[model samples]
Target: MKTRAITGFFFVVVMLGSFFAGAAVYSIFFGLLAIVCLQEFYGLLKKSGSSPNVATGLINGAYTYAAFAALFHWDVYPEAQTIHKLVFLLVPAMLAVFVQELYRNTDKPFQNIAYTFLGIIFTIVPFSFFHALGFVTNTGFSAHIPMGFLLMLWANDTGAYLVGRQFGRAKLFERHSPKKTWEGFIGGIIISAIAGYVLSIYFKELEWKQWVSMAIIISVIGTLGDLVESMFKRSINVKDSGGILPGHGGLLDRFDGLLLAAPMVFTYLYFIFN
Candidate 1:
């Protein structure tokens, strides 16, 4: 527990620094993290008795980093249409992987390649939304965007854990995540909403209604993200993705909720404001 707490603290500091630093810096930091996560994911795939080409893994990671950099640093697509184009890229890439699998004739080739792609998409795409959000600035609001989103996520997670430990009775999803309770989930939403309401006051561009809506979205979707990662772990028969961080397990373990939450928050901000 002490190790986990220390690691968690270190993670919070680094994330806070990255959030305040600006888009390019944050993108590079997270890009490296994405690469690490992809490597860990490939390890899991290998453990499943399927070997994805290491070069393919590198390609996937590069594509992900490029997609994010383009979305944020360049106007590759209209602001509203970026994600759709990103999705389009996936089809051709996955088709290429499928063709490669046919030639390899390895154990469970298709399923392994398919799930590996899914994991990457699931973990990386939503974060691109945050990267894009950093670009949607009203001058002074630049620093506020990432920090607000990070705080809201932190608040939600903290709220759920505290409340669940105290008064959790009914389970939320027993098979996917046994410790989560419906009560704690609701508590998390409420707490996060409160935090969002406070943040809205500072972010001049966003209305209170929009902020609260985002909070609700984050709480619910973030929980689902955790469950999704849990599902992956269960499938691979692992406790954590890696032991890179003493308490946090790996980049994936620490950011699972953010992976889902960031996209929802970004979409809400984009559609409502733009």
Candidate 2:
């Protein structure tokens, strides 16, 4: 218990610091996070009797993140064509994973290669969307954009845990996650909506209606993200994703809410802005 609290404290501190410190810091932090998460994902696959080409996956993810961050954070590419050129590197890098599989001589050659790409899609792509959140409004990379999204996510988690413990009876998904309950899910939505209202008052970047919609998205989609990760763990018969965070399980466990939420939220904000 003490270890969990200690680890959580430091985690929150680093989280806030990376968020507010500026775009460069946020990019560097999440870029590294993307790599670490890819490794851990491949670790899970390995335990399940699959040998994903982690090296190729990691390298590809790193460059993919770098290119996206360059385009968004630094505004390095003035032209959309140039950005496409940068992203085109992923084409060959992805193929390289298949090529590398030949030398690995794994019995499940296609499966290994497929898992390699899956790891990148599941872990890195969502994180890249999260990185884009910092610049969602073209406001020159403030924490407000991403922070608003994260606050709702955190609210949902807290509310769900608290309410689920006290009043949980019916199962939300007995197969993937036994602890979650419908009562808790509703509780999370109510609390997250309240949090979104509070955030709208102070942030002012998004109006009340927008914030409410965001809260709804976060509450529903974010919970799905959690369940999906839980499903992943259940498949591998693992308790936690990794032991890197002590009480937090692993980076993947802690940030699982962002996996599906990030991409959806990004799409929402994009549609709203455009």
Instruction: Please write out the lDDT profile of model 2 over residues 1-274, one tens digit for every residue.
Output: 9999999889888888899777788999999998999889999989888888888889998998888788884463355546646877878887898788778866889998889889989999999999998888776676887888888998999999999999999999989998999999999999999999999899987888899899999899999999999999898898888889987888999889999999999999888777
lDDT of 1 by residue, 83-139 (tens): 536745856765676677777856677676776676567655665666666666523
After superposition, candidate 2 runs with Cα above 4 Å error? 74-84
| 190 Cα displacement, candidate 2 (Å) | 1.0
Task: Evaluate all candidate structures by whole-model CA lDDT and list the values in order.
Answer: 0.75, 0.88
- Best-fitting candidate, measured by TM-score? 2
